[model samples]
Target: MKVYILWHVHHVAVDEVGNVAHFENGEFSARENLGDDVKLLGVYSTPDRVERRISVARTLPGFRDEPDCFWSAEVEVDEDDWASGYVTE
Candidate 1:
């Protein structure tokens, strides 16, 4: 299964440390649970620009939430072979 953090109109909360941890010697701190580096792919908007903007205020683990039309998930996903680079002539 793939995991991703999606938000709309606002940034997700993150701790002072980036998404990593170092367990050396005998000290450790909280590490980011979301694995892998995430990057912004693109931005999407409702077809009707005049539509109201909805924001994701909070989130819970293992819980699924509905995203507003204006909200977009900024994560990567596997591209279908045909969609990526399959050709038939």
Candidate 2:
């Protein structure tokens, strides 16, 4: 099953066009610049549900200021993610 993970980040977020400052090989994409004030708002089963939640959240305080900060990513359930062990430097 696909789940929509909602996230709210606090930062001077940049648009897609200016997100990457360099073009090494081909077009490279990155989200490493997003600041550390990340909030896991909620996870919904459907996109519609995610939309509904976002709409309401946008009307609320704090969130209203950064309405565009809201975003959702679809991920499958019961998936073996990060099977390879990670390292901490």
Candidate 3:
């Protein structure tokens, strides 16, 4: 059994860190756009189980400052379990 996973990310970088350095506001918008596009593709066998995720990260201005922030999401499905409605090629 084989499982298919789709992952997407969109980000707008900023120069400095401050009240909006993390851009939580833009994060929602970016997620909405990406989610809408993913839904439009209609490529998943199980729409109900279709997984979506958003991630945001930041680094120092000049040198690598060891990840300042990170976010992610994950979904697990049993490919062998047809009950999960896996698509077959």
lDDT of 1 by residue, 1-89 (tens): 22243332222334457523333245432233433222332334432321222322224221213232123333345533355676567
Candidate 2 lDDT tens digits, 3-78: 9999875554455675522222453223454533567899999999999998998898888876767767899999
Each candidate's number of clashing pairs is: 0, 0, 0
Please give the lDDT score at residue 79 for candidate 1: 35
Error of 3 at 13 (Å): 1.5
Question: What lDDT score belongs to each candidate, Candidate 1 first?
Answer: 0.32, 0.71, 0.32
Tens-digit lDDT string for candidate 3 (12-74): 433255222333645632234323121221233443333331112123331122232233333
Which candidate model has the greater TM-score, 1 or 3?
3
Clashing pairs in 1: none
Worst 10 residues of 1 by lDDT: 61-70
Q: What is residue 52's positional error in candidate 2, in angstroms?
A: 0.9
Which residue ranges in model 2 land beyond 4 Å of their true spot?
Answer: 12-35
Better by TM-score, candidate 3 or 2: 2
Query: Clashing residue pairs, candidate 3?
Result: none
Measured with C-alpha atoms, the lDDT of residue 52 in candidate 3 is 30
Candidate that would win on TM-score:
2
